[model samples]
Target chain A: MKPFTQHSGIAAALLVDNIDTDQIIPSREMKRVSKLGLGEGLFAGWRYVYDGAERAGENAEFVLNDPVFRNATILLGGANFGCGSSREHAVWALADFGIRAVIASSFGRIFRNNCARNGLLAVELAAEHVDRIAAQGAEPVDIDLEACRLTLGDGTTIDFDVPPADRDMLIRGLDYIDFALRYADDIDAFVTRDRRSRPWAHLRASES
Target chain B: MARTLFDKIWDRHVVRQLDDQSLLVYVDRVFLHERTGSVALTALEEEGRRVRNPQHVFATMDHILDTFPGRGDRTLVPGGEAFVKTMRRTANDVGIRLFDIHDGRHGITHLISAEQGITVPGLVVACPDSHTCTLGALGAIGWGIGTSDCEHVLATETLRAVKPGQLRVTFDGALGPGVTAKDMIVHLIARYTAAGARGFAMEYAGPAVEALDMDARFTLCNMAVEFSAFTGLIAPDATTLEYVRGRPYAPQGPDFEQAERNWSELRSDDDAEFDLEYRIDCSDIQPTVTWGTSPEHAVGIDGRVPDPETAGDHDAGRAMQLALDYMGLEPGQPLKTLPIDGAFIGSCTNARLSDLRAAAGILRGRRVARGVRAICTPGSQVVKQTAEAEGIDEVFLAAGFEWREPGCSLCFNAGGEGFAPEERVISSTNRNFRGRQGPRVRTHLASPAMVAAAAVSGAIADSREFAETGTNGQDAA
Candidate 1:
């Protein structure tokens, strides 16, 4: 996962609310054995012709295909982005597409966490603020994780909030597994106590 | 202390709280499907981190398998066999329980988890599939995680998660006939938009929920993900205990009694506090169906399609307009009158034995309407066998519906069988996203009975009306 600190790039505005993981990367595209090379499969349902193949010709109506935003590294989206399914491929596709940041009013919990875990900055701002940023399509916007702010070229700055720990992990390029393992003692203590408290809850293979 | 049901279960599982306020919690059960599970297993294998507890981990080959009768270890999706074989080999090498193709226990992950007693109450269950929350009906805390998180859990029987705020949705009053848990959940999603329950662990309670059977409770919790909720739960009760008493994986005798004793105390205290509360009168809901791409675009069977232009502030107007446009539906059109090309009564959402019975009741004496291709895929081999024993399969087959084996069929047009582009389908599946069933395929999310009614009418017809008249639904149309 790449570390996030400060990034400035072209922003593409996709103002569709409830952009489910299914719509982002349909299940059909997730059949690949490896997670590599799913960037072309991103939004394949809406991104390409209905030929069941990738890059079959872009769907002209889709904003992602708009030549103006072809090099977009930031995505400005509507509320409740990534609402359905917990497919990490949704984030994989976004990252694979060269999108380093996504700004939305809100996001699905799993999708948001997946973004942070994978080093994609998922920024949540007020709906009004997001609308303002989304209106500036394909324009350069600067996102500073340490500053906790996004700056438009016209000197307009909007503050956003990310969990301090999430921001630290992103800034330090840390893995959750390592972070979690640091608290192994606590997990062990809890499990030890819980076994006595709820002995029947244990799944004994012998019972089956 | 008066702790909510979620707090009780969550506190029990907390391994420790990190500096970030997120808890590293022990997970009792982890179920995986081929679509995403294979990735996690392969990652774990590559990392050389063996599963911490193989008995606690269960893998099943769903999602990509063909639901066709006599199907072997083959799949319709190109290169899909690799996933099945990988899951098989990984489960074998790791000593995790695997429900392979042709295994009588093979089924959708969530369904089999409950049916096989893998998801007992007072435990935390995790899975890569979003609808893993379905097991919450058993009074378990079920969290849906991505493949990366799945890998983490496979290596260590715990996951680091931010504790969610609590929300309680209580359903009061009596449910009208033919109004199922599916209707109630769809109504809830429609009332509160898709993100209504965002960041909340929701508990379904009150008289209506308490009165529901175990299977119906699963239906309600299954759609909790549609609301963008972290998870959904219902405290275990006598009904739940009765349902799990003799399942193949459930405890027996003295151990079962001890489990019951623990589960009995798993409910939210009367004085428990919630961050939010919503109360719905069960009688207010009707046989519901989603008319647009998102689940929140639901309207009652008797209601007309909404005029997006009349939507209030916020993105309501634009969202509604987009949904209507993609659905190819006109404002003010009746939802029940629209013709359908396909009717699918299968998926993790509503493919249980009881769901099949509900659909069979409507399809008993009537054939699927002319030109309508209807398919009934049971949720598992166990469900299929049980339905067959009860003549439910004969009812469906005799009604001109294709009877298929269990997996996930026609739920989404991934690679195998599905409706053609522009074809309208009323499905019992959870999602109705644009092009989900096929390219340009218009899907209406509905209950099993509703899907059955549509199949018999070749159009969107109210299931309650068919239930009342016991008609084939063509006459109603």
Candidate 2:
């Protein structure tokens, strides 16, 4: 995982609210045995037209199909991005497609957590700020994680909020599991205490 | 200090606090399905980490299982059978319970969890599927997690999590006839768009919610994922106790009595404060259905499809227009007049015995409309057997509906058994997204009874009127 510092890239605007993970990558494209090569499945349903069991051509109207935004590294999404399904494949698709940062008004809980684990920068901004960014018409935008601010091409700066822990992990490029392991002793102590307090809740070894 | 139901459960499960931010909360149970569970289980094995508590975990082959009669390990989705086989092998190697295709307990993860009493009140349940919140209807702290998080929970039996801010949605007036819990949730989502409950732990309270049966409560909480809430719950009461009593895995004898005592105190206190609150008169909520892609794009059954010009914001208006184009619908058109090419009646969202019974009642002496293809997939093998014993399957089959095996059949078009591209469908499933059932297929989300009505009429007909007046002379709403 690379520590996210700053990036400037053309933004691809997706103005539809409640863009769920299923729409990001439909279930039909999730039949793979491995997590690799899922970029082809990113927005599979919306990305192409099916001509009787074969790919006919790309849907030219989709934002991703726009040649100008083809290499977009930043995504300007509507409210409630990554709203459904816990498939980390959604993030895998975005990262595989070179989208390092996704700015939205809000995000689904598990999707945001998955983004953190997968080293994807999920930036939550106010809806109006997002609207302004999307209206820039493919202008390059800059994001500075250390500063926690997004700079529009119009010389306007808007501060964003990131939880302190999430911010620290991003800057340091730490895996959440490794970070969580630092508190293993705390987890052990709590479990031992809970086993005593709620004896009935914990199944005995023989129960299995 | 009095606490909310979720607060009580959260406090009980806290193993230790990580800091002022999050707690290492003990996960009481974890359920897995073939779709994503194989990844986590295989990862745990490859990483050489044995499941910390094998007894607390369970796996099932539901998502990719073929619902066709006499089907075995084969599936239509490419590599789906491999997923099933891998899950079976991994679950066996780990010594955790595996509900294979032949297992009588085999069913959708959420439904089987509740049916077997694995999702009892005051417990914390985790699964790798988003609709895991469906179990919250039993007063459990159930929510979804990704594969990586699922692996962590398998290795540690706990998750790092912050306490979600609480939001309470209360419904007062009585729900009119033919208006099921499905209608209530669809209405709620339309009122508060998909992100209305974002980041909050939601509690559905008030007289109407309390009056719902256990199965109906499951229907209500199943769509919490659509609301983007961390989870949605209803405090356990005597109704819940009765539903769980005598189940295969529920506590018995003195243990049951002890559990009951604890669950009785699982209600929010009168003075409990919420970060947000909403109130709805249930009577105002009619038999509702979505006319577009998002669940929030819904209206009453008698209402017309919305016009984009009235969508308030420009972006919203554009989105609405796009949805109308995708759905092939026109503004101001009555939903009842919109014909469907097929009908589906199964999913984790609404495939229980009650849902089956409702659909059967509508199809008892009726026939599916000509040129309309309809299928009924039971939620589980147990539900399938029970419905058969009660002659519900016969009723559906006689009415020209295909009575298939239990699994997530056509809810998602992952399996090959789905409507053709551009075919419009009225489904009892939760999501109605574009290509959700098939490429370019339009889906109208509705309850099982309403789906049956649509199948019989070949259009989006309201079940309320169909029930009051028989289907004999019914035109549209």
List model 2 lDDT by residue over A159-207, tens digit each. 9987776777788887666566676787788778876655555655564
- What is the C-alpha lDDT profile of model 2 across B160-254, one tens digit per residue? 78789999999988877778888888899999888899779999999888888887888899999898889999999988898899886666676
lDDT of 2 at B435: 77
Clashing pairs in 2: none
Measured with DockQ on alpha carbons, how good is candidate 1? Answer: 0.64
Tell me the spans in candidate 1 whose CA falls farther than 4 Å from its real position. A51-55, B468-477
The global C-alpha lDDT for each of the candidates, from Candidate 1 onward, is: 0.85, 0.85
| lDDT per residue as tens, model 1, B1-477 | 889999988987877767757777899989998888888888877777778778788889878888888887677787788888888888888888888887899898999999998888888999998898899999998899988899888877898777899999999986887888888899999998888997799999998888888878899999999998899999998888888998878877887888887788899999999999999998789899999988899988999999987877457678888888888889999998799999998988899877888888889899999999989888888999998998888999999999998888888863266788778999999999887787778999998899998999989998887754221111110
RMSD in order of candidates: 2.9, 3.0
Error at B12, model 2, angstroms: 2.0
| Model 1 root-mean-square deviation | 2.9
Q: What are the chain A TM-scores of the candidates, in order?
A: 0.94, 0.95
Q: Name the 10 consecutive residues with the lowest summed lDDT in model 2 chain B.
A: B468-477
